[model samples]
Target chain A: MPDAHPPTRREVDVRGPRFAAWLTSAVLAVALLTGSGVLVAVQAAVFAVGALAGLRYAPYGVLFRVLVAPRLGPVREREPEAPPRFAQLVGLVFAVVGAAGYLAGAPLIGAVATGLALVAALLNAATGLCLGCELYLTVRRARPARTA
Target chain B: MLGGALALTALAAWWQRRRDGAVRGADDARGRTTTAVLEGLGVRPGEADLTVVQFSTAFCGPCRATRARLQQLQATRPGLAHLDVDAESHLDAVRELDVRRTPTLFYLDRAGTLLGRSSGAPRPDELTALVEAHVPAPGAREGRDV
Candidate 1:
């Protein structure tokens, strides 16, 4: 056999995802601390945009590409899009749940949801430890094997 | 609450980094034979004196780095083969190997016995040492170095 699998999709600057994670951490922190429905909704919208449009078009990603990336010079390494994209979907899940919790008059649920996302984002931003990416791998491992 | 989250994040990062790229010997208890598994993956036992089998997923960033480093090592080292397996498509092997993370690597000897396993991207020095310990010097194994 030639190989088990084909090459993955195009690579991305690893810094872009880290920058977005920093932004997500900040937004989630504010939402969780204030227990403000508006802030939660705004954070949820950010997650929605990222999950739906991908990091390339997301506001934070664009900011990184235009501002941060230029200052950092060329990156020697790039990573696959699947992990970070999966992370965005995970963020979307928590953000949407938090938004719904806040809108439904249950501040505790919103706080918990936002708090979980905040930890994941902070871990990625501060130390490059992506919990969401780990989760994505775990989910793949749990799924049934596909025909090779 | 924010302080707690920050502290927790720090702790998690510390723990993750501590174990991230470190290589350790495999457990003797788990001593599961991998010859059949290697055959299933199209790698016949004794095909190479030593093989570095890396289990990776599409979304894993460290897996890419590991692949590059291992391939580089293979270029200079004879009797050493590098095999990359997509963990997503090979769930049975993943389960058999008890791999919970991406970029998990299994080192195999000539007879396909699992020697050591490393999770995450291993440091270049560590990988070099591991390869050197298993694979003989370039000129020793004829026709094995390609």
Candidate 2:
């Protein structure tokens, strides 16, 4: 039987996602340190935009495509889009939870959520470790097989 | 707190890389699988000299790299077959094979006997060497030359 959700064949510039991760890491760090509800909300909005609109339309993605990629010369390889898109969804989950926590006056909850997201973002930015992609794979493997 | 997170992230990266792309021999007991399991993965018995059964997920970055490398090897090496199984769609095989991660590759001989396994994207040189070790030279067969 054919797989319903096959790995995407369409390639994307890997740098774009890493650049977005750098931005996300900075924003999440600020949100965690300052305990600012507004910052958390803003980060959440960024996550939402990235998750829904994809890297092409996301702010940092545009920045990478326009400014960074050209200076780096041609990339030898382009990665599939699914992994980074899944990572964006993971970021969205943390951002939404962090925003809610901040709005409810629970700074600790907000800090923890944002801190977790920051850790993941920093890992991607520094080491190219896509923890969210790993989580997505784990979840997919754990789920029961679908019956046609 | 931020410093601790950084340390943890570094540790995680180190650990992931240490194990990433390393191929090891499969345990004889655990690696044994019937032809039925191979059939489930759409591989016919004796179809090729060696079959690379790669279990992958849709959202795995390493899986893509693994696939590209394996396909490249398959293209150049005769009697090498590459089968990519989506773990999401083949949960039973995943469980039976005890695949805990994406891009887990099961190396099987022509008779469907499991030889080894690799959990992440294997290095191209290492992969080539491993395949060469398992597959006999062209025109060499069973202590007789064709």
Of the true interface contacts, each candidate retains a share of 0.65, 0.49
> What alpha-carbon RMSD in Å does predicted model 1 have with respect to the real structure?
2.2
Q: Best-fitting candidate, measured by DockQ?
A: 1
Candidate 1's C-alpha runs over 4 A off are: A144-148, B27-29, B140-143
- Candidate 2 lDDT, B5-49, residue by residue in tens: 677778888888888778878656666663457577677537778
lDDT of every model, 2 decimals: 0.79, 0.77
DockQ, all candidates in order:
0.63, 0.50
How large is the interface RMSD of each prediction? 2.1, 2.7
| lDDT tens digits by residue: candidate 2, A1-148 | 3253373666688878888899888887777777877887887787777779876777778888888999997987788877887788898898888888888988778778877888889988987878887776567657766752
Tens digit per residue, CA lDDT, model 1, B11-51: 88888988987877755556444555656777654777787
Q: Which residue pairs in model 1 clash with each other?
A: none
* Weakest lDDT window of 10 consecutive positions for candidate 2 chain B: B137-146
Clashing pairs in 2: none
Candidate 1 residue B103 Cα shift, in angstroms, is 1.1
Write down the TM-score of every candidate.
Answer: 0.90, 0.88
